[model samples]
Target: MTTSLKLKDLSKKEMLLAPGHRMCQGCGAAIVVKMVLLAIDKPVVACSPTGCLEVTTCISDYTAWKIPWIHSAFENAAATMAGVETMYRALKKRGKISQDISFVVFAGDGGTYDIGLQSLSGAMERGHDMLYICYDNGAYMNTGTQRSGATPFGASTTTSPAGSSVPGKMQHRKDITRIMAAHNIPYVAQASPSHHLDLMRKIQKAMSISGPKFINILSPCHRGWRSKSDDAIALSRLAVNTCYWPLFEMDNGKTQLTHTPKEKLPLKDFLRPQGRFAHLFRPENEWIIEQSQTQIDADWNAMIGAGAGASGVIEE
Candidate 1:
């Protein structure tokens, strides 16, 4: 599979997401979200949970969103989107609102994988025709870089600070794709900013599918991760190459990897770039790297097993 994706071919129109936003330099979430909105031209109603995206896009008296948007609490984006979907369907039945509108809920990893998991699960279990997108920055970036379920092993966060004995986050990152797939939804996929074209393609696929679709986007954060502003795309690419974040999709029923690295890079190549794992580079912090690699190996093995009967990894 080609790592060099044609992200701009999906839509040739001018950028819908304008400039002068409050997002920090090299913020991967901003670019990915922009491409997400650009993937579909139909009317859209978005339910956003409280997080960095919400805070930056919906500041007091300042709105950068071009589509119909609703600001909900941190843990209720799924529920809010459910209500909006219900209302839209009801209105369409009554000939009060058009049926062409698409409903999407955007939340952070903390909101989707932890606090909002119940509501999200409920919405998916109930089979709502909506898309739930989780921008996995790997921690609670808005309040603080606290250790969330999405935080990778050995990465340091506010809640998982390194100490004399404790290296960093002790737990492995949650397997969100598998968790969503277990819901038996129509679609579930993982994407990253490095593969913008593929990301947009999956967004369109999710929108067209009935029932529910869940997307876990690996959006790197410069502020929280202590990475360089210009290394966003490089970091994103390294994450996939290192198997720290795999790119794949679970279609109507079949699961397949979207991209398999030509050569798997070491976990250190992925972790050492960010200051979050800087402590892990110390002489005595070798255990952190070893544990991290073990976790990645386990995940890739499980993915291979689950997709054994399916076709080879999907090509662009």
Candidate 2:
């Protein structure tokens, strides 16, 4: 079911997520949605949880989505999609529907990694034929920049503020991707809008599979991350280059590193640009930076070791 697509060829396709929606300038979630919709040629029924994407795209009676879309509760996007997919299967078996369709659910890190984790886990375990995508912007950006389970250690947020007393969020981000992989799903991957082609390819590959696929995309938040509006993609690129968010996928049970950095940059290169991490740059907070670097190095080494034969960028 995977389509053979090239970036150059995608320009001619009609856009599914239209412009003039209320998404902020340079919103990474919007970009991820556009790319995902473009990669799908079949009829799509999308379910979105209460988040920035849902609020902006479906304001009042006006909707920006060209396809059939549903706005679910704050913590049940996956559950709602599972019900729809189950009904679709029943109807198909009864010969009531003839056309092909795809089911996809979109949720923020707050919904995916925390509140909706039970619902998502249940659906995946039941082997639902649907795609669950987490557009993780680190924190709950739609709700006044509150910290979520996916917020990385030392990142400032309303709930986890940085000051002389405390240094931002004290816990590491939950590895939701690995958690999803543990279900033995057909497909699981982490992607970012910084690498458009790689994301498109991953989406295509995920869609080709039959049951329960998950893709967690690292979407940069302008307001929450205290980054420049235009720095979304740049920050994402820096994330990958620094091994802070290495691109990789798990097919069935085999893990693969998709786009490894040729020369892995220092973690500071990725963190120093964002105001949220500005406090960590102080001389007094040098230990926080060193600690973060140690964690990143450990993660990168573990990923490289796990994906032993996976293809990625090789040094010259």
Candidate 3:
């Protein structure tokens, strides 16, 4: 599955997700869906849990998805897709289904990290042939921007508000990609919309695999993060540059860093722009900023020790 898909080549492919859906301006999740769909050439069957993507794209008979799409509950997207894939396999064995249809589940971090973690684990453990994509926008952006398991530390949310009493969410975000990698699946990668080509290449690689594959994408939420609508891509890039989010993949039991910054930028470059971390920028909260930077540095060092560096290749 070696594909050098230029942007012009994507325009030539038919889009499975049509425009005019009710996604917010510059929604990273929407772009992820588009890019994923464009990367695959096979017939797709998409399953989405209860989240912004499901709600916005599917509204009572008027669907924006040109491909066959299913809207599942908040916690059963992976299970549902696994069931569908199982049935497809049965049909194919019985000579009823001829086409090689691919099954993909798109869920928010709330679904993947918290609500649907068990189901995702079950599907992966069962060795289901499917792709699970988690569009991680940090907090639960669909239902009032509440803090979820994926929300970063010192970030304000409705449930974890920044005020005189408390800082934002006190806990660090879950390393879901690592967790999934522990499943020993064939492919597990972390991606961001900022690097379109890298993301597309990972998606292609995931599609080429025959077993369970997972990709955790750091999708920025404009409304939830209190950032400009047009700044989603910029924020994503800063996330990579500051080493807040390092792009990597785990194959078998080995981990490899896919992209490493040439000259890593300061954590402030990524934190200062988003209002969620605005509280940390205060004079009194300088300690929080220091703590955050220390944590980032520690995580980056660990990732590099695990093999990410100038070459961006980590062989276990």
Top candidate, metric lDDT:
2
What TM-score, to 2 decimals, does candidate 1 have? 0.93
lDDT of 2 by residue, 1-316 (tens): 4545666678888899988799989899999999899998788999999999999999998899999999999889999999999999999999999988999998999999999999999999999999999999999999888999999889999999999789899999999999999999989999988888888888888888899999999999899999898999999999999989988999988888888787799999999989999999988887888998999999889887775444755321
By lDDT, the better pick of 1 and 2 is 2
Q: Give the CA lDDT, 0 to 100, for residue 231 in model 2.
A: 95
Query: What number of clashing residue pairs does each candidate have, in the order they appear?
Result: 0, 0, 0
- Residues forming the 10-long window of minimal summed lDDT in candidate 2: 307-316
**Model 3 ranges with Cα > 4 A deviation:** 1-3, 310-316
Q: What is the TM-score of each candidate against the true structure?
A: 0.93, 0.97, 0.96
Q: What would the per-residue lDDT of candidate 3 be over residues 60-120, giving only the tens digit for each residue? A: 8799999998999999999999999999999999999999888999999999999999999
Report the lDDT tens digits of candidate 1 across residue range 1-316. 2112255554465465667668888788898888788786567788888888899987788887877889998788998999989888898899997658888888899899888899899999999989999999999998879989999888889888998868898888788888999999989999988877678878888877878899999999988999898998899989988989888888866888888887889989988889999999999989879877887898788888886333444453
Question: How would you order the candidates by TM-score, starting with the best?
Answer: 2, 3, 1
Which residue runs does candidate 2 get wrong by more than 4 Å?
1-4, 312-316
Checking candidate 3 for backbone clashes, the offending pairs are none
Worst 10-residue lDDT window, candidate 1: 1-10
> What's every prediction's RMSD, in angstroms?
3.1, 1.7, 2.4
